[model samples]
Target: MSAMVDTPAPAPHPVPRRTDGSSVPIGALVPLTRPGWVEAGRHLLAGIESGVRDVNDSGGILGRPVELVVRDTAADPRRAAAAVEELAALGVAAVAGEYHSVVARAAAARADALGLPFLCSSAVLDALTDRPTDWVARLAPAQSHGWRIYGEFLLGAGHRRIAVAAQQSVYWASGTRVLREHLAAHGGTVVEFDMDALTPSAVCDALVDHGATALLLLTGLPEPAVSIVRSVRGDRRLDGVMMGAPAGQPEFGTWAALLGEDGAGIPFLRYLPERLGPLGARVGTALRERLGEAPSFVAFEGYDTVAALADLLGTGEVGRERIAASWAGVAVEGTRGPIRFSRVPGIGVRQWAWPPVQVVDRDPAAPGRFRVLRTG
Candidate 1:
C-alpha cells in the first residue's frame, strides 16, 4: 500500500483588521457651517477627535480602534435627518454629536427609526429626551435641570425680582417656563420680555421699572446674549443687577472678549464643573492645544459622548440593542466627573441624570478662570 502523503494542514486565515486597526465606525453630526453654531461645532469636533485618539491610544476598544465619520448638519433639521440616513447607509455602528436642539430632535428621530445608537452631545432642550428610546442618550444636562439650577442660584443669592430676556422658540420657551415656575414657587418673580422686540436700552428701562434685582438672559443665541450684556452694561441703572445667561454658557469666553471688563462678575450655567480630575485635565489640555482656546461645556460633552460610546462598544457587541443595554448601566469617569444615566421622569426617559453642572462667574482678570459659585 502506497503511503498516503499527509496534506499539510491548511494555514489558518488571518483575522481581518482595518488599516488603522479600527473595527467600529462611528458617525459625528456637527454644524460646521451654520451661522451661529460654526465655532461651537469646531470645538465639539475637536473634542470628539481627541476622544477618538485617546481611545485608540489606550489600546482601543476590544483591541479594535474606532473610526469617526464626520457629517455636517449645518444646524438644519432636514439636513440633520439626511445626515443620519447617510451615516446609517455608511454602516456606522453609532451616531453622536449635535449642537442645536432642533437639529438633535430631527437626528434623534432618524437614528431611532434606523435602530442606530445616538449619543446627543450638547443639545439641552428637555423635550429631546422626553421619550425613552432604546438607542438615544444625552451627555448634556436637560434645560429643565439647568433652569432649576439657575433659579436656585438666583434665589439663593437673595434676588427676589428677576428679569428675563428671551427669544420666542421652543428651547427658550421650555427654559423660561421652568425658570418661571421654580422662581414663582420660591417666592421670586420673573418679568419676561421679547428679546427681539426690546432694544438694550428698552430692556434696561423695563428691568429698572420692574425693580428687577437680577437679569436672566435666555435668548438661546450668543450674539443676542452678548448684545444684551453690552446694553445692560452700558446703562449705569442696571449696573448693580446680577446678570446670568444660561444660554451663553458655551460661549462665555466670546462674550467676555466682547464685553471686556463688563463680562466680569456675570454668571452662567456651566455644564462642565470648574474642577477637573486627572483625565479631565488631560482632555482639557489636549483641547486647548488643538483649538487654541479653552474647552467649553460642549467640548466636554462631545468628548464624554465618544468616551461613553467607546465603553459601550468595547463590550464586543455592536448594535442598537446591545449598546442600549450596556449604556443604560454605564458609569464611566468623564472629563467633568462620574458619568451615569437614569430615567428622568417628565424629561427624557434614559438621560444623563447627574451631570456635574456649576454656575461659573467670569473673571476679567483671568479670561478663562471659571470661578464656581454653585454646583449641582
Candidate 2:
C-alpha cells in the first residue's frame, strides 16, 4: 500500500471534449491500467458513459450535456487521492467511479476533506471514511451488509468450518472480519489461510488439515486465486469442498476466460435483483450494446451513480456544497431498484442503505451462464 497524499498532480489526460460550453463535466476515477483490475474498470466506465448518454438523451443535467473528465487510478491509493484532487482542481461537479475498495477509501478521504460530493460507483469496504462527513456517499452495499448475507448462505448450506484465503489488503481483511463475526454468531468458524505462506497444494492440504467445509478466495484475480482454484478442482482430495468468492471475482468475463468451468459454482456477491425491472432492462440492453457483452453489476452501479447524481443535479441547485448537502433527499429509480441514501449505523458516509444483494455463480454445466443461488 502506497502512502496516500492529497496533492493536485495531473493524472491521465481527459477524453477529448469541446470547449463550446455545452457539457457538464463530472470527474471519473477508474482503474484503467495494471494492478487495478482493468476488466472491472472497463465495465464501470462503459456504464458511466452509457448513463451519461441516457441522461443527455432524455434531457441533460439541467439541459447541459455531461462531460466525463476521466482519470485512471491504476489501483494505487496515492494515485486515487491525487486524482480526486486533480478532479477537484478541474472544476468537476462531483467525483464518481472506483472498483477497488482501498483506492475508493483514499479517494473518499480526499473528497471529504476537499468538500467534493462523491457518489462512489463500486467498492464496498465498510469503513470508507474514518469520521462522519457529508461529502461522500456510496451506491454499493457495504461489505458487512453483503458479506454477512454470504455468511448466512454458507451456514444455511450446512457449512460450519470455513477457510478464507486472503491477500494482504485492508479490503480483504475487512471482508474476512465480516465473515468471521457473522459466522461466529451461528456456530461457524473461519480459518485464515495466509496467502503469502501457502502454495496452491499447501492450500489444499491446509483445507484437509483444518477440515474446512468451504473455501473462500478473498484474493485478487488471475494469479493465486486462479491457480488455487485450478489446484483445488483437480485435487481429488478436496472433492465436494465448496469454493466461494464473496468479492465477486467470477462475475467478470476474465474469470471464465482464465478458469473456464473451473470458475463455476464459486458463489460470490453481486448487487442486482434476480430479475430486471423495466428501467433495469432498458439500461441493461444499452449497456450490453456498449460493452458488447453482458454487463456486470459493477456496470449498473456506475450507471446508478450517475442516475442518482443527475436527479439531484437536474432538480435543484448545482455546486459542490449544494450537492454534498442534498444527499438525504435523493430518490430515483436506479437500474437495480429505487435508489435512496441514508446514514446507516456504523457506516460513516451516506449509503444507498443497500442495493439488491445476491449470491450467484456460473452454472457448472455452462460457464457462460450464471445461476442465482440465493437472493436477499
Candidate 3:
C-alpha cells in the first residue's frame, strides 16, 4: 500500500493556445533601395508575400494573420535604423531587411537597443561579425567565405598573382581586403587597383599600371564591372589576365561578345546558385510579368528573409525574446543551404556558402543567359 501510494502525478500537458493573441504574426521593413533594388525586392517580396498569405490562408501563424510592414530605408544606414525602430513600435514579432551590410549593422544595433530580433537579408561583410550581439542575424555569407572561395579558385587555377579592381566603394574595398588576405594565406599576392575614376580610359590606365595575373572586380552591378573588363580587354593591355567576383551577374552574356575569348578567363563568385530552382524561376517569371524585369540577388535575399521569419512566426511565439531564443540554432531548408544563427557573438548571424561558378559561354543572342563553367 505504501509503495502504491508513491505514484507521482502526471505532468500537465501544454494546451494549444493561439500564438496570435491580438498581435501581428510577423512584419518586415525593407530599406527602399535603387530602382533595380526596389524591383528586385518587389519580386522577392512577391514570393514571400505569397508564401505568407498561403500560410495565413491555410490557418495563419498560430491562428494569427501575418502582416508585412514595409518602410523606405532609402538604402541609408540612418533611415534603416529608424525603420527598425519604427517596426518595433508596431510591436512586430521580428524585423528583417536591407541589402547593405553597413546598413544592416546599423539596424542590428538599433534592434539590439530595442531588444528586438533582426534578420539581415543580404549584408555579407565579414566585418559584421567583429562583435557578437544577440539580436542581429544575417542571411548572407561572410565576406571572408566569398573571398576565400575566389582566392582558392585563383590559386588552384595557377593564378598565383592577383590584382583586385574596385570602384572605391565600400563593398568593393572590403572584398579587396578579404581577397588579399585569402590570397596571401594561399601563398599568392594581390595588388589593389582603384576604379573610382569612373572613365574607362582612366580605369584602363590604372589596370595597366597595376598589372597582375588576374583581376577581381568587386563592384555591385554587371554594367560597371563589365565595362572595365571590356575596356581592359579592348586595350589589349589586360589580355591573358583573368577577371572575377560579383561579375557572375547574368549580364556577363551581353559582355561576352564584346569580350569574345577574353571573357573566358573571367570567373565570378555567385552565392547560392543551387537555390535558384523552380521557386526562383517562378518568381522571376512573375516579376517579368508584373514588373518587366527579373530578380537578382537582392530580390532573392528579401524573399528568403521574409519567408524564414514568417515560418518562425508560425511556431506560436512571435515576440522578439522567444524568436531570438529559437533563432540561435534554428535551421531552415533555405534556397541556400541550412540557414541558421551562429551561437557565436558577432558571428552568430545567418551565413551561406555557394560553389564558385565561371561563365563558359554566353548566349549569342540573349542578354543575360550564360553557360556555367566549372562550378566550385
TM-score of each: 0.89, 0.94, 0.78
Q: Where does model 1 exceed 4 Å of error? A: 1-22, 220-222, 364-368
Instruction: List runs of model 3 lying over 4 Å from the truth.
Output: 1-25, 31-40, 197-199, 220-226, 247-266, 273-294, 344-367, 374-376
**Candidate 1's error at 240, in angstroms?**
2.3
User: Candidate 2 residues 255-329, lDDT tens each?
Assistant: 999999889999999999999999999999999999989999999999998999888666555456766778888
Error of 1 at 97 (Å): 1.0
| Candidate 1 lDDT over residue span 1-376, tens digit each | 0121222222221223345655777899998995547878988899899999999899877788888999999878888989988988787878999998878988887776666788899888887733456668888888888779878988889997988888877787888788889989978888888977987778888988999999887765466777788888888887789888776553545666677677777778878765688999989999989988887877888899988888777665534566666776677889988777777776643588878878878776875566788988
- Could you say which candidate leads in lDDT? 2
Ranking by lDDT: 2, 1, 3
Q: Using TM-score as the measure, name the better of candidate 1 and candidate 2.
A: 2
- For each candidate, the alpha-carbon lDDT, in order, equals 0.78, 0.88, 0.60
Clashes of 2: 0
lDDT of 3 by residue, 42-148 (tens): 54455456556555676666666666777766567777777777777766677776666666666766776666777777677765633455556767667666656
Best by TM-score: 2
Q: Clashes in model 2: which pairs? A: none
